[model samples]
Target: MSERSAGLLLEARGVGKSFPGVRALQDMHLELRRGEVLALVGENGAGKSTLMKLLSGIYTADEGEFLLDGKPLQVSGPRDALEQGISIIHQEFNLMPDLTVAQNIFIGREPRAGRVFLADRALEAKAAELLDRLHLPLRPGQRVGDLTVAKQQMVEIAKALSYDARILIMDEPTAALNDAEVRVLHDLIRRFRTPDTAVIYISHRMDELKAISDRITVIRDGRYVETLDTATTTMPEVISRMVGREIAGGAGPEGVRDDRPVVLSVDRLSTKDLLNEVSFELREGEILGFAGLMGAGRTEVARALVGADPVASGTVSLRGKPVRITSPAEAAKHRIGYLSEDRKQLGLLLEQDVNANIGLSSVKERFQSFGFVRAKAMRARSRELVDALRIRTPSVDQTAKFLSGGNQQKVVIAKWLVKDCDVLIFDEPTRGIDVGAKEEIYRLLNDLAAQGKSIIMISSELPEVLRMSHRIVVMSEGRVTGQLAAAEATQESVMHLATLRPETETVR
Candidate 1:
């Protein structure tokens, strides 16, 4: 702890919380000193979010006490927390799209003339002042909808600053940002360090913690593990504590790369302003990893290949024949399926039952007979998949909305498997899934590869990319900058490729 923290800013001792079927946190302890950035780290479902919510008054702790400046404090709600100098920036931005930056920043307490009329000039001037201090190149008059995602996130931070927040909690703040934008966020965090301000930085990326945090706190299975000084502890030590075990070296199935033939080949694929000369090859029984920062066109390439997005110029060859795939239906005809990152929006129908969602991709062939749906056959197939994938559902008739994130992902996987797709593109497959479920998904991928099914896995987590990839394709600014065999790919090498770009390219 630093000397500036002699007078602590916030302390959470013996905090406990529970939900319907989950005990999220118990005997959790955390202390934040003034001017210190406390990095909260855990695997998914480790009670990090639960604790943050309690601090921001989104959820009240079932037990323990929270003290601020040596005095016990009880926050009633979000508004009360904000009034008490506590603010939280969720992963998703909460700004009104149609409003200007200044209006979004000063939404609740606007400067008014005679306390009746809106004072637009005063609002813009104050917003501009804050932006200038943060060194953000955004205008108060600019509409939030017009800004890029990174800029919109900056506006979120500016809004938090508008509240004069002394205690800030940022959850996964850099998940959507590219490398350059991440640098900007790092600078902003540096500026927030002061004698009266305390920050709780939560992220899955260890590299960011190394760059931004003064102290690191590890939580496991909703219990406090330990805390380490960022400058003194090694990364392996931190990861071991976070996971409670040392991670092995080898990632996926070995000795299958050189033997399998190329199943899908993309040559010079280009999408409108999104993908530029993107090209890759997926071998049979291989997991080809796509590694890049967000907005690096990895997802764009997947969408274009599967006909979710139009490819301006490209040739896709399946096996030995070049084919024209103009739509998802056409792609499915070729035994190709895409599991989108956002399953709720693009992959599954929330209102539909498990059987319906599973049979949707193969409705014409598998679930329909002579202009009538085969309910018995569909139920049988869905039941088989449910058992095979170990989906925790009471019945195939259960709605997709009621399933957990991991089970939902398994359902998505079942949908593709039922369609008998030979080539599968999984974008952020293990995202929002807990550690145990993540291992299950990894094992399933390995099993699929062993069965001669080719997969293209796109992940923002570099560790995941390193672990599951037989070969990695790195993209930057929509271009394939480099490719690496799994045996030779390191985090440093992958990051180097991820940051590379053409000299003429200008990043947003």
Candidate 2:
């Protein structure tokens, strides 16, 4: 135990927590060493976030103790943790949109002029210096909301550094980033691997876990399983650890190819991004997964298909029936559903009740005599959907904002389900879910496909692409580089296409 704990700067031993009937976490153990990037992984509800919360003072551990530098310590909250040289950068960054990057970073600790006026320019200068050190090309005077997702994340990192954070916790940092942006983050994480800092990196991408993590820690159902060195471990071994078994083959995940029909066909599709003369077809009753590296314009195609974004030009056919998708509403009228990658911003009505969100897309149908909505019917229908989709909520009346990321995602699916859409485009469907919920989602997708509902799944996870897809589409830059049947697709081949190629270069 001493050997395993050697050189550890922070450690949490035998951590446990529970919420009512759910044992959210139990016997959870973790350690952080100087100059190490530890990847913490588990299924949604496996208590990855819970454990992090405990470490960072978001939640007090119901049991066990946290030792900072081998001495027991107590973390009260974000402010306390920050003061203790620990910081967390969440997926939803906590920066003020109206504030400039510099102001946001050095917010409360502003360089004051005689304790009254803020030396705004001086603050910006300082922030700019930090951004430069981090290799983030962000102008300090820019507003947080105005920046791209990746840039905003960089800003958060810079802010963390301002606190002199020795330990940084990053949650799904690249979930919204393009490949180029991801590279920038990769470089930033590497920068933290200096002699004194420790980075706790959490992500669902196994490929990234190998590429970035020095050590990988597996937690399942709230228990610390094992930690393996990145050089000595395989992705399959890591996945097996996370999921607790070998996944027996079914139809393969949405991205893997199998014997299936093409349900929705896109012929000569063009978009503003990397989608150049894109053409493809999705088959009903098969989870057709779209596999691409970041910046592949897969999301752009999905956006275009649902008319969430404009298409430069294209013809979309539903079961060979050509249709014009002018907007999301029009696409919905054609029985097409699109789940946005930015669910919080575009896909959900946070203030509304779960039933309200589920019934949102089909509220008109709930109308009865005198054009009045049947509230009882809506609640009844939402109840059925809750059961069917396994949405975790106190009741149908609960706000969409109150649910966890996984349950919120399920609600989004329920909305489309109520709409009875034939073609469902799931963009990063399991983005923040733990292992258990992820498998449940996989099964749900399979059931949806089995019911002859055509699915266009867009995911960055290679295993999901390999396991769920019957056919795989590889995209790079803004164009389709290659398509491989399930039998032909491998991580190496997929990644080869995923790698960026210069436009001047010719495609074989």
Candidate 3:
């Protein structure tokens, strides 16, 4: 341990937890010293969330000792944790959209002038004070719904500060923030680092982790691996520890051929707020990448192309002719399918079985006859997909909600496959999945491309963009700033284009 036990602000010794068939955490140990940022890194489902719940009092440790300030910590609930000067900011903001910032911060513990009356002014005053202390440019009376995601996150931090929290836990804080917003958040975190405060940061972004963390603790498969000082440790070493192996990076555009004809073409595409005359061509069997920071219009392009969002003015050409796509169903008729980044909400029905989700897109054509459904055919076809994708499930009847994140993603892919879509748009395809599962998905994508599927992949992760893309289109401020053949694309060049503004030289 770099820090001494006597000065440790929080400590978890021999922590263990389990859910019904999953041992999420076992024999996990953590120590957080005063005035330090401790980064917690692991693959998805590696017990990072479980450990966080234990720390925040959402879940009790089945076996372990929690010590705070040199004493045994006894936290029975969230209230107890808060009272003990611990606060957790989840990935999703917990604030009610309709509520004002003041209302959200002091919701349950509101000040009252009398037993029967409320004190709105007092609440706003207190909230304003907290925000002001943090140097946040937000009004206490402002509705959380109206604020940008970055501003709303600031409100979450302000709420935590209201309790004079000594320990703070932030989970994927910059997942929704742009590059500029990320810098603002990093400044706030640095300001919050006091001799009396300890911070636990959980993130998957390697660059952010390296920039903000003092020490990194890696957890793999719910077990502690090792802790290293961020300044001294290399990224490869850290990744190796977290995933238990080196992640093999691919050579640019390997095995891609120029002879493949254009399968899809977008000409002068524009959306109301997001896209601005964006144009690109995807060749058959090509993986074209869209690289950008958040809100750079990467996802907007995907949505528009698939008819999930209306295009203000554009021409979409399949093969040699133009086609009008005004809805998702219409896009499907053109054989274009989209895999959303928020797969849980947009891609799959959690309550439905794998077979249902896989067969959903093609139900009319494959499983329906004379207004009647063919359950037996649906099951048979879905079973084939399950075997082909190597989706781990007891049977095709297993509910989507019960499957792991990776397997759920596979089911989403299966839906497109069943629809016989040759053009697929994958938005952040591997976003919350484990490393092993990521490799599987990569292989699956490669297989699809080899079979003549054209893919437009949108990703925020630069490394992922560089590794899998045959060609990359960099977007900035709703415009295509630059295009690069895979062999010439690097993190620096892609980011340079990604940060280029509308006022800058047009590179498209």
Tens-digit lDDT string for candidate 1 (1-508): 4564356899999999977556878999998988999999887667887899899898999999998887898999989999999999865577898999999988988899886899999999989998998777789999998675557778887888767789989987776565666788888888777989989998867788899999999999789999899999987788888778775444554535466798999999998877887777889999999988867888888889888888899899999799989888889999999998767657899899999999877888888978998889989999999998778677898888656555788899999999988999999887655454567688888988889899999987788889999888998888888888888889999998888874544321
Residue-level lDDT tens digits of model 2 in 64-152: 99988778889889899988988888866778989999999988898877868988878888888888887777898998886645567
Taking the tens digit of each residue's C-alpha lDDT, what string does model 3 give over 34-110? 99999998876677877887888888889988999878998898888998888998765678889999998888988
Relative to the true structure, candidate 1 reaches a TM of 0.77
Model 3 lDDT, residue 155, Cα: 82
In model 2, which runs have C-alpha deviations exceeding 4 angstroms? Answer: 1-8, 11-36, 57-65, 70-76, 96-155, 161-163, 177-191, 194-196, 206-276, 317-322, 366-399, 481-484, 492-508
TM-score of predicted structure 3: 0.83
Pick by TM-score: 1 or 3, better one: 3
Superposed Cα deviation of residue 165, candidate 2 (Å): 1.2
Q: Could you estimate the TM-score for every candidate?
A: 0.77, 0.78, 0.83
Indicate the worst ten consecutive residues by lDDT in candidate 3.
248-257
Where does candidate 3 stray beyond 4 Å?
Answer: 1-4, 92-163, 254-258, 352-411, 503-505
lDDT (C-alpha, whole model) for all candidates: 0.84, 0.80, 0.84
